[model samples]
Target: MIPGYPKETFFVPDGIYLLSHSVGCLPVSTEKHLSDSFFRPWANSGGHAWTNWLDNINAFTQALAQLFNSNAQNFCPQVNLSSALTKILFSLPTPTHRNKVVFSARDFPSIGTVLQKYCKTLELEPVMIPQDRNLADPQTWSDFLDEEVSIALITHVVSNTGQKLPIRDIVQLCRDRTITSIVDIAQSAGIIPVDLSHWQADFVIGSCVKWLCGGPGAGYLWVSDNNIHECQPDDIGWFSHKDPMSLTMNNFEYAPDARRFTGGTPSVIPFTLATESIKLMHSAGIEHIHSHNKKLLSRLASQLNVNSPCQPNERGGTFVVSFSNNQKALQTLTSAGVHCDLRSEGLRLSPHLYNSASDIDTLAELINPLLGKRR
Candidate 1:
C-alpha cells in the first residue's frame, strides 16, 4: 500500500466498512474542493464563473486520465454509466446486416435496461451471454462475438458476483472482427488497473463515487484515440460542437477529440469532488491499492466458514459470501456495526486500502451468526 496514505486521505469511521465496492468512503478533502473549486468561483465570479469551472472539468479529466493511465483528451465526463453508454449506443452507425449488442445477464442492470430500449431501433439487437457459464478465463467472451455482433459491452468486473471478465482478449477479438468494444470499469476503476492501450478498448465507462472516492454524479467515459474520427455521436449538444461559441446551429462540426462524445451543459460540482479523489488515488497508486486489498481480503476469506464465490486472485478488491438468507445476513452484520452490502449473489464484502486486517477480522467474527454454522 502507499505508505501513510489512507490514514491521511480518507474520512472513514472507526467501525468496519466493507462496502467500497458499492460506494466508497468520502475523502476529507471533499468539502474543500466543492467549496473552492465550485461554490467559491460561482459566488465570486457570478455569470463569468464558467472560466475556472470549465477548467475544473479539464482538471477532472486529467485526474481520471492519470487514474485510467490514458490521455486526458480522450476522457469525457458524464453523470452516470447509463448516460455514457447511451452516447456510445446511439453513436453507432445504423447497421444494414450486423444488429447485435452482446452482453451477459450478470452485466449491470442499467446497461441491460438501456440496451432493451435501443434494441427496438432499426438494425439494433441485443444478444445475451450466459452468466451461468464459467468466467475464469478472460477469453470467454471471444466465442460469443460473430459477424452478427455490432457492439460488445463487457463488464470488466461484475458488480454482484465480483467476476472479472476477460476484457483484454475480448477487446482484441472485437478489433479482429471489426466490432466496437465498450468496457464498463465501474467496479474496477480504483481497485484494478484499466489501461486503454493495453486492452485496445474502443470505449470505457466508469464512475467516481465508488472506489475513486469522488462521490456521486461524476460518471466518466473514455473514447480510444483510434476510434474517435469514426464515431459521430447523435446525442450531442452545444458542447460537442467544434466551435460552440460560433452559435451556428445549422453548421454542426464536432470537437475533434473525445469531447465529441460530450453533450449539453456539464455538471461542475461532481468533477470538483472527483478531481481530488482521482488525484489522491493516483498518488496512492492503483497497484498499491490492489496489493493491499489482496492481502486484506486473504485475511477476511480465511475466517469465512461459508464458501467465498471468488478466489483471492480472480476477483477485484471484493468477494461474495453466500448465506441461506443473504438479506438477513446483511441485516445481522449491519446491526452489529459491520457495514457491508447485499447483492444478487450474496453478502458483498469489499476491503479497500483504508480497511485494516483487524477490521476484516471484526467483520468476519461478527458475521458468524449468518453463516448458519457455529464459529
Candidate 2:
C-alpha cells in the first residue's frame, strides 16, 4: 500500500478502529472548528449569532455539493436519512396505479420502517424484493421494477454485506418505469463517488456521522436537476418557505430547490464540525482513499477463510468476515484493540484513509485464530 495517512490526523481509538461504516473516527480539526466557528460566535454574540451560523449552513451545503459535483442549491440539511425520506414520502402524490415502493428486505431497517408508515396511511404497497438472489449482483433487481412501482428505495451499499446495488442502472430502470428513485448513501457517502447530480436520480440521502467524519446531527438530501423545480415536500417550516423572511399567512410557498425539503430550525454545530472533515477529505482525494481502502480489503480477504466474497470493486467501505462464535471472536478483537461490529452476515470491518495496511494485518493476525472453532 502507498505510504498511508498519518494517524495523527484523527483522534483514533486506543485499538485498531474499523467501524467507519457505523461512526467515523474523530478528525483532529473538529475541536478547533467547534470552538472557533460555533461556540465562539454564540458565546460572543448572544441572540444575534444566527447570522454567522447561517453562513456555516451555506458553507456546509457547499462543501457537500463539491463531493457530488453539484452546487449548494442542490442540497439541504436534515436530521437524518429517515427524516429526509419521510419528507419525500409525504410530498409525492399517492399514485392510483403505481403505488408500490420497491426495496430489499435486507436494506437498512429504519428505511423500511419509514416506508411502512406510508404503506399504512397512504395506501402504498410494500414490494420487498427477495433477498435470495445472488448477494453481489445488481442484475437481480432488473425484474423488480414495473409500472406499479412508484418509488424505489435503494441502499447504495448494503450495511451488512458491503454489497452495492447497481444504482445507475436501477435509476435508469426507474426512469423507464416512471418510478421515483430515492437512494440511501449512508455507508458509501465519503468513500465512494455518489455523484447524485450526475445520475439525476429523484433523491439521495447522506449523513455526516459515518464515512464523512462529520459526526451526527447533519444529514443531507440531494434533489436531481430534473425533479428539483416541481418537488413539493409536505414537510414544511417557515425556514423552507420560498422566502423565509417574507411571510404571508394566506399564501405559503416552498423553496425552489432542495431547500424545499428542509424544514424547521437546524442544529448549526454540525456545519462547523463537518467543515474540517470535508477539508481533510478534499486534501486526501476520495478516489485515492477508495483505491487504497479497496486494496486493503482485498489484502485482508486474502488472509480470510470465505467463499466467493464480493470483490473490492463490487462493494463499498465494509467487508463482513464470518465466524462460528462471532461473540467470542468479537471479544477477542476488542481485547486486542481491534474494533469492528457484528451484523447479519458476519463481523463487519470498515477502514478509512487513516487506516494502514499494518493495522489490517494486525487485525487479521488477531482474527485468524478465532475462525471456525468456537473455543
Candidate 3:
C-alpha cells in the first residue's frame, strides 16, 4: 500500500524494464546533477575543481552511509566490486595456519574467478560450496568454515537465483571461527534493508550500478572499525595516505579509516552521478520501495512458476522463473515489450518502484502461453 512513488523521476525504457538486477534505469536528474556537481566545476575552475569534486565523492559516501545505517568514515570508494575484492584480498595478511578461502558455487562467477586467480598466489585454497548445497542454510556455511578456513566471501543475495542468504548468522559463524567475512551486497543493497551494524561483517563490498540506479565505476568497500587497522592494503597510493595533500613522498601512512583502501586519484565523475541517484532513493525510502517491489513480485508469483525462494523474505527484488524454451521465451517476452534477462538458472524478472501490478499482469499474460510450449 505504499504510494507516492515518483516513477517520473527515472527515465525508464520504452518497454518494461525488469532488468534493474543488471542495470538500473537512469535517474531523470542524473545529467543535471552531473553537470552541476562534476562538469560545471571542471568547466568553471579547471585545475581548481578538485575541491568540489572531492566533496562530491564525500557526499556519495555520506549518502551510502545513510542508506546502509553506518558511519560515513567506514566507506571507501572503488572502481568496481572486483577491484574492491582485490584490494581486500591483497590487504589482509596471509594466514599463518588457516589457508582456505571459502565461497559458494552459486555466487556470481566473477567472485569465484577472483578468488581462484588470487588464492593461488596468496597460498590460500579456494573452496567452493557445491552447487547442490543449500546456500541459504546457515549450517551449510558453518560446516564449511573449518579451522583451515581463513576467509569467507558471502554474497548477500544470489544474483541468478534471487536467493537471499542469512548473512548475519553466517557472519556470526565466521566470527566465532575467527574467519574473516567479506559480504557482497551488490544484488541486495538498494532493494533490501541493509543494516551494516547488524551484520558486523569484517568487510562488505558492492557496486552502485545495479539497483542503486548509479552509473558504473562507483563501487564501495566497508571495513569494520575493529578490523580496519589490521588491514595493510598492497594497493596504496597518494589517496590512501593519511593526508592526501601532505606532499611528503617519503613518509606515506595509510589513512586510519577505510580510506586506506582507496588507491591513487579517485574517479570523481562516477561518484557524482551515484550521489544523485542515492539521494533519489533516500527520498523515496528503501522500506517503502521494498514493500512495493514485494507486492508486485507476489502478484507475479501467483501466476508464474517462480524458481526463486517461495517466501518473500527468502528472496530479493528479482524472481527467477523457468521456461520450456529459454531462448523462445526470452524472444517472445522481448517482442511483447516485457524486458528481462535470462540467467543460466532461469529467466529473471525484477520489479522496481516504477513497475505496477498492471505491468505484472501484462508479463503474466504474455508468459503464461509460453511457459511450457515447444519451440
- Estimate, for each residue in 1-375, the C-alpha lDDT of model 2 and write its tens digit: 334458788898887889999999898878988898888889999877898998889889988888878888989988899988888778876678877888888789999999988888987789897777653465666677777888888888989888877788878878887889998999888888767656778889889898889999889888887778667788778788888878578668888888887677777887778877887786677898888888888888888776224666677888888888878788888888888888878889998888888988987788777875744
Stretches of candidate 2 exceeding 4 Å from the true structure? 1-5, 307-309, 372-375
lDDT against true structure, model 2: 0.82
lDDT to native, each model: 0.83, 0.82, 0.89
| Model 3: lowest-lDDT 10 consecutive positions | 304-313
lDDT of 3 by residue, 238-289 (tens): 9999998994869999999999998799889899999998888887888888
- The alpha-carbon deviation from the true structure for residue 345 of candidate 3, after best TM-score superposition, in angstroms, is 0.8
Ranking by lDDT: 3, 1, 2
* Model 3 ranges with Cα > 4 A deviation: 305-311, 372-375
Model 1, stretches more than 4 Å misplaced?
Answer: 372-375
Predicted structure 1: clash tally:
1
Error of 3 at 107 (Å): 1.0
